[model samples]
Target chain A: MNTKELVEQIYKKKSFLCIGLDVDLNKVPKHLLKLDDPIFEFNKAIIDATQHLAVAYKPNIAFYEAYGIKGWKSLEKTITYLNTNYPEVFTIADAKRGDIGNTSTMYAKAFFEDLQFDSITVAPYMGKDSVEPFLSFEDKHTILLALTSNQGAFDFQTKKIEGKELYKNVIEISKSYHNAQNLMYVVGATKAEYLSEIRGIIPDSFLLVPGVGAQGGNLQEVCKYGINDQVGLLINSSRGIIYASDAEDYAQAAANKALELQKQMEEILLFKK
Target chain B: MNTKELVEQIYKKKSFLCIGLDVDLNKVPKHLLKLDDPIFEFNKAIIDATQHLAVAYKPNIAFYEAYGIKGWKSLEKTITYLNTNYPEVFTIADAKRGDIGNTSTMYAKAFFEDLQFDSITVAPYMGKDSVEPFLSFEDKHTILLALTSNQGAFDFQTKKIEGKELYKNVIEISKSYHNAQNLMYVVGATKAEYLSEIRGIIPDSFLLVPGVGAQGGNLQEVCKYGINDQVGLLINSSRGIIYASDAEDYAQAAANKALELQKQMEEILLFKK
Candidate 1:
């Protein structure tokens, strides 16, 4: 999925919220857990209840993968459900995978061709060779990890190199790679103040902003700095939305949380215009 | 697997070769394509033929993933075959997966717990949050991509910021992360000249060296500069070894290639001791 289409989807829906399905099997309700594929069942309920409130549905691949092939199958089922039921909602495989050239090709095939995720999150440490392989796939988005939300990001990402921060240099040098047109990035909501500087580097690319809600990053703070003319931010809420309730009304509670995010994003969209 | 155990296996077998299964289905023997799972069939045959000659097997995850669930299952089967038959041979899930703190936890589960891979390749873009998650897994090795064989590696990996190359900084910074003892690195054999410099930075960590065969990287030169007291190198040869022939004799041909590498490694061991 290209930046323009993602932007269009957000504008059309008047929402920039990307609902994150970072589900944990042990935490899932016992009723659903009884099923053959409890993870997929829970995801199906969440997707059904909250699809209208989301412009994108981001599934952190690790959660499903923890269940082994069962988890991978659930991931497959979840994507299949999204494709079949809510085709309009953009799908992000929150799979931060990066490797060598040949290996990246296979990852591209898994996410783009096999599993059919609209976008796959990538770690850009291996440089352009690891990244370009993902970018080479037509219209498939490769979301680079730029400035992450966690505290440890300050360790190396924000480290002062010559006169510049490594994170800043990463963003600048990444722009020079071929076919980087489909690239977006993860610039955390916690680090919202840097949006202006980050935007200057990659003005048009959408940013997958996490660290809102459960992470204590304010939506207003993120929207203030992150929202571009295209509403260029996918502010994600994973634990805050998916685990809003463990009761029978879990899906409904998820919808409520998702709706709150959608409402906030709608206001941000209004201000951006 | 732990470093000492891996070293002992290498010494006992008289080989330091980790045959890379960067297999593409289209590149495999045509006759095998008729099987229900050609990829697994090809891998099983190769493993059976060469397990005695090689102390380790590195299956690049991308190749299996390209085929989707089938590809992943093939990987599981390949690992299962190795574990059941040749329990001592180190198994590497050549999946270079690294992400933000929360997400990296999931990725660690995906490969280490779910798939039962002994080792996984990781990207170090988001610094500690991304890499620390993979390292947290007890006893499992996380091979971070340091220097690679491809042309595009020079794009960002070699970019100088503070008079130090990005790869150097990555290795130095990564060394400080918690539970870093299990960390190895992917240093391309083609860049053998930098092997000594890399060894200087990381004198202890095993270097998983690729680009050794068809990519024209010199094995002898890599050994000269990269080898440590422990023979701290897992020299990988993929296409040139496994696909040495396209006929039914493909597995035997792989064995021949592996034996050739084992013979060289044996000679190198003599020089070391």
Candidate 2:
């Protein structure tokens, strides 16, 4: 899906929420383990429960990869299900993958062509050549890691390079890449205060903001600075929503948690209008 | 495997030559495609042919991931083959993965525990928390990307951060991480000049050097500055070695190419002694 369709979905749903499918079997309900594919089942239930409240689903690839071939199978099933069931919801492969030019092209094909995710998160450490391969795919967005939500973001990202923060330099430099209109960014919600400066650099580009409830990032503060005319912010909540309750009503409980955040997003959108 | 074991293997083989198994189907022999698992069969042939000459094997994860589940199955079978047969050879998963603390742990588990690689390359843009999890794994090495072989390395890696280059800062900061002894660094052969300054920070840490032949890096030039008492470098050659020929004699051709590099590495080690 392109930026226009994503924005349309956000407006239609009254929520720019992106549910994170960072599924860990240890954290899921005990009953689900009896199923043939517990991970896919858990994700199917959660996606069904909260599809209305979310415009996107960002599946953390690490969670699936940890399970090996079985994990890859589950991931394939999950992506297939999403595309077949709810093609309108934007899908993000939270695979922070980047490499040398040719190698990166292989990765781009893996996520964008084979798995069929609308977008895949990419690490910017390897710089232009590492990232441009993903950008070459038309209509497929490459969400570059700008200022991450984690504590480690301060280690190198916030460090000054040529008298400016490295993340800002990343944002500024990435804009000049080939077919850069397909670029989006991963800006951590934990650093909401930095959104204004980030917005100054790429005001129109979409920012997939993770780290809300469980990570102590306030939704109001994130929306206060992050919202654009098109509402170019995907506030992601993983543990806070999906792991709300591990009982049989776990899906409903997840929906309830999502409802709370969606209501806040709805109010914010209404107020902005 | 521990650092001691890796160094021992390097000396025993008299070659720190790391064969890169970046098997692209397009480049492989036409006959291999007729096999049920061409990728695995290709890797098995290359490993069997070149196992005596090379001390390490680095499988580029992107190549495997590109094929989806079948690719992952090939990867699993290839790794299993290596571990079961050539148990003495060191393995490196050229995944270049990193994320937040918890997510990084999952990735570490995927590569180190599930995949059972002796070492895995990780990007350092996320800094301490992203990398320390990989370090925590006993005997498993975390090769952090310092100066990559690609042209994009000049984009941000060479930029001055706090008066020192970003790669140097990465080396310096990473040393303070927990279980820093398990940390190795990825210093591309293209930037052999940067190896001296990098050696100044972590002399004992192994450097996984790619870009030897196909990318125009010299073994002797790299050895001059990068070599330590243990001959701390794993010189990787992917296309130059593995894709040497695409005929029925592909395995023998690959072995011949690997033998040339192994001979060069032997000369470097002798000269150093």
Candidate 3:
């Protein structure tokens, strides 16, 4: 989906929430094991439960890839399910993938063409050519990692580069690339305070914020600095919602958790008005 | 394979060449398309013909992943073929992957456990936690990108941070990780001059040097600054070797190309002797 459509979905749903589909086999309910593809079955239930409450659904590709061929098939099934059932909802392959120009084109084709995700998260370490291939796809978003929520973010991302933070430099420099308008940034919600400075760098660009629910990021604080006029934020919650309950009522429990977030988002939007 | 075993293989073959199996369907011989799995068939031919000339096989994962499910199946077949028929060869999955701690563990499982590759290339942007998980796997190698061969490497990699180049800092900091012994660095052959300084940081660690022929890197220069006591370098040549011809004699041509590199490397090792 394009930025305009993404923003439209947020306003229409009264939430900029993006549910993360990071399924782990050990954590899943025992009954799911009976199915031929438990991962897809689990994802289908969660997506169905939370579709109305979320504007986006991001399946972390690493989770599916761990299972090998079966895992890849599960991923295909999940993406197919999302596109077929909820055409209006945005999809992001939370696959932090990047390589050289030609190789990256192949990756762009894999995620954007074959698997058919509206967007995929990319690492900025490989620079412009690695990322530009994904951005070149018209209307498709290439979410670049900027100030991630992990402790490792401090290892190099937040370090000083000519007096400015490395991530700040990344955000500033990336804006000059060709088709820069199609670019979005992944700023972890755990560093909500950094969002204000990040906003100063790219005020108009959408940010896919992941760390709110399970990672101890406060929603109010993230919204305080992250939300733009277009509600330019996709707050993602994975384990907190999907694994809320592993019982038979797991889907209902997930819906309840999503509904709670949606209600808070509605209040946040109303307050902005 | 362990460092000892890898060194043994290099000496046993009198070559440390790692042939990259970056198969492109359009570039392959037309006759191969008539096969059931053209990509795998092409790779099998390349491996069978060139296995005696090279000590390692590095399949650039993006090439296969680009083809989606069928592509992944081809990857599985190629790896299985290599492991079954040529057990002595070291396999490197040139998939530059990295994510959060938990996510990276899944990737480690994917490449090391499921795919059973001896090594997999990982991008260092995410820092300690993202990489440590990969390093945690016993007897498996995590080849971290220190300085890439691409033009985009200058964008951020060569930039200074606190008076030290970012790539240099990456090499320095990563050495302090939990299982740093299992770590090897990827130093592009184009930057052969940097190898002396890189070698200074991790004297014993093996470096996977790409960009030899197709990218205009001088093999002699790379060997001059890169070779350690164990002859610590796995020089990769992809297009120059694999795409040597488009005729039915493509496999034989590929073997000839690999033989050329192997002879050059043999000369380099003989000089060391």
The per-model DockQ list reads: 0.62, 0.91, 0.87
Q: Which stretches of candidate 1 lie over 4 Å from their true place?
A: A160-162
Task: State the C-alpha RMSD over the true interface residues for candidate 1, after superposing those residues.
Answer: 2.2
TM-score of chain A of 2: 0.99
- Taking chain B only, the TM-score of every model is 0.98, 0.99, 0.99
Over 4 Å off, model 2:
none
B1-273: candidate 1 lDDT, tens digit per residue: 678899899889989999998888778999998999998899999998998888789988778767767776887888888888888888888777766676778788778887778888887766777788888888899998888887767866787756888888889989998998989999999999999999888999999998998889999999999999999999999998999999999999999998998899899899889
For DockQ, the strongest prediction is: 2
List the RMSD of every prediction in angstroms: 1.8, 0.7, 0.8
CAPRI classification of candidate 1: medium
Residue pairs of candidate 1 with colliding backbone atoms? none
Better of 1 and 3 by TM-score: 3
- Candidate 3 lDDT by residue in tens digits, B79-141: 999999998999999999999999999999999999999999999988999999999999999
Q: Model 2 clash pairs?
A: none
Query: Candidate 1 at residue B107, lDDT?
Result: 80
Interface RMSD, every prediction, one decimal place: 2.2, 0.6, 0.7
Model 3 misplacement above 4 A: none
